[model samples]
Target: MAKKNKIGEYLYCITTKKDAPKEFNIKGMEDSDIRVMFYRDLAAIVSKAPLKEYEPTEENVEKHKTVALHILKDHTVLPVALGMVFKKMGILTSTMGRVYFVLKKSLNLIDNKIELGVKVILPKNFEESNNGKSIEELREECKTEFAKKLDGIAVESKEGKLFSDRLALNMSFLVDRNNIDKFSDILGKLDDKYNDLKVQYTGPWPPYNFVDVRIMSRGK
Candidate 1:
C-alpha cells in the first residue's frame, strides 16, 4: 500500500540495454508508467506497485508477463521474481550497482536465446503405425525423433511434467533466436509424422526457464 512517503517499484525483469520498446506500454497496479531504470549498461524494467503486502492476483501476474514479453522481443532479459518492490529507490540502485557485473553476465549467458514449449497429447486408446503397436511405444519413438532433430540445433532442453493422463510429452527447449525458423521447420516435420496425435507448440519467450536471476532487496 502507498503511504504519503512510501511507494515502490514492481520489477518485471532486467534487460541488456536501455532502449526498451516504447511502443509496448503496460500499466502497473496503480496505472503508473512501466519504464527502464538504468545501472551502467543494465536496465531494470519496472512499474509502480505496492510492496510487502502485494498479492499476485491474476491481473498483476499478467501485467508482469506482458511487460516482459514486449521487452523480450528484441533484448536479452533476466526476469526478476514477481511482486518485488523497493521502498526506497536507493536500495534498488545500490543492489543493482553491487551485482551489476553478475546481472550482465546472466544477460550475456542468455543472449540471443529464447525458450520454446511443446506438448503432445494422444488418445487414451491410441494405436501406433500399421504394425499395431501401443500408444506408449509410439510416444517414445516420437520423443527420440524430436530429440534427434534438436540435438545439434537447440542449445539445451528440459523435460516438463505431463499434466494429464493422455499427455505423452511436455517439455521445453532453449533455442537460439537465429535458429527459430529452423526449429519451426523441425517441428513441422515431426507434426507431419505424428498426424494422429495433438501437438501444441508455443514461444520464443524470454528464456524464463533458462535464465535464473531474482532480485531480493532487503527493503521489504
Candidate 2:
C-alpha cells in the first residue's frame, strides 16, 4: 500500500468574520476542499493540501490568486502571501492570534477599497506631433499633469517600473469601490485630451501594491 500524504491547511487570504461567507464552493491547491478557520474576528480561508512546499508554477499561482479574487466578490480581503501552508491547524490559529491587532488595523484602513493600474505610453511619432519635444520633457509633463489628475481620485498610489522608454507612467491606484467609475471617467478624459499618448488602464483587483501581508509558521 502507498503511504498517505500528510494533510495540511493552505491559506489563501484573511477576512473579517462578518465578511467571510459561511461556505465556499471553490476548490483550492491540489483540488482540495476549501474551508474557513477563525481566530476571534479574523477568518482565514484555507484548503487541504499535503504538508510540503508548493512550487510557484503558473497553474499553482493562478489557483492561489483565483481563490482570493473569488472572495473579493463580497468581502474586503487582506491577501496573505503565496505558498503559506501550516502543518497543523493549531499553528494556523496561533499565528492569527499573534497578528490580531495588525490584521484588524490593516482591514480597517483598506476596507471597501480596490486596486487599479494605469500605464501612459508615448506616441511613436513624437517628433512629428510635438515639433521636437524631447523624451525628458514628455516624461515631466506626464509626472506633473497626468499623474496628478489620477492621484486626486485615489486613496493611495504606487509607481511601477517602466520596462520601455515609450512607457512614461506606470502607476497603481488604491480607489474606493464606489469611486471606480469616477476614476475611469477622469482617466478617459485624460486619454482623450492627450491623443498623442496611449493610456492603458486595468483593474479593481486586490490591493496587492498597498498591503504587505505574510504570516509564516513558527511565528516567523
Candidate 3:
C-alpha cells in the first residue's frame, strides 16, 4: 500500500509560460494550493497530493476539474487527465520536458477556443410529428445538415455519444472565444427552426475535446 503521507506533484493542466499567471488562488485535491511550475517555455498547473492514486469520486473529480476551469477563465488550457500524480517534482518536470512539443502543438491548436456541447433530443412523439420518419433517419439528418450548419461557425466539431434512441445528435464544438455570441445566435436560430426538438446546450468549458497531451517517462 502507498504511504498516506508520501506526497507527490498533482498536475492539472499545461499552458505556455507567456499565458500562465505566476499565481493561482484556486484549491485542488486535498485542498492544496494550486501553483505554476515552469520549464523554460512551458508551464504546468499543479498542486501537492498524496502518492496514492485518487479515487474517481464526484467531489474528487470536481476538485480536479475546478482547477482547470479556473485557469481556463483566463488562458488557453491543455487539461490533463484525472489521477495524474508524479512521485516527485523532478519526475513531473522530466515528463513535461519529454512531452513539451506535443503539448505546445495541442495548445496552439486550441488557443482562444472553448468547447461547447449540444444534444438534440427528439420529442416523445417524434415519429408521429415528423411524417413517420424513423429515429435513424433523423440521426442522419443531424449528422449531415444540422452538424454542417454548426460546424461552419466552429473551429472544429466532434460527434459525441448519442446514448439513447431519443437523442438525434450529441456533438462538441471548438469555438473561438470572440465568436461565442455569433455561435449562440446561430444555435438559437436552429433551435427555433426545430421547434419540436429539445436542444440541451452546455459549456464555455476547457477544450477537453480538442487538446491531446501524451505524457512520457524519462527512460523513453
Error of 1 at 5 (Å): 12
Q: What is the C-alpha lDDT of each candidate?
A: 0.77, 0.85, 0.82
Candidate 3 structure, TM-score to reference: 0.89
Angstrom error of the Cα, residue 153, model 1: value is 1.3
Q: Quote the lDDT for 114 in model 2.
A: 85
lDDT (Cα, tens digit) per residue for candidate 2, span 1-220:
9878788889998898888888778789999888889889889999989877778899899999888888898679888788888888898998888889999999998899988999889876465335466777777777777668978889999998898878878889999998989899999998887777889998767888899888866732
Task: List TM-score per model, in order.
Answer: 0.86, 0.86, 0.89
lDDT of 3 at 67: 84
Which has the better TM-score: candidate 2, or candidate 3?
3
The residue ranges of model 3 lying beyond 4 angstroms of the native Cα positions read 1-5, 123-131, 218-220
Q: What is the lDDT of residue 95 in candidate 3?
A: 79
**Distance from true location, Cα of 146 in model 2, Å:** 3.0
Instruction: State which candidate has the highest lDDT.
Output: 2
Clashing residue pairs, candidate 1? none
RMSD of 2: 2.9
The RMSD of every model to the true structure, in order and in angstroms, is 3.0, 2.9, 2.5
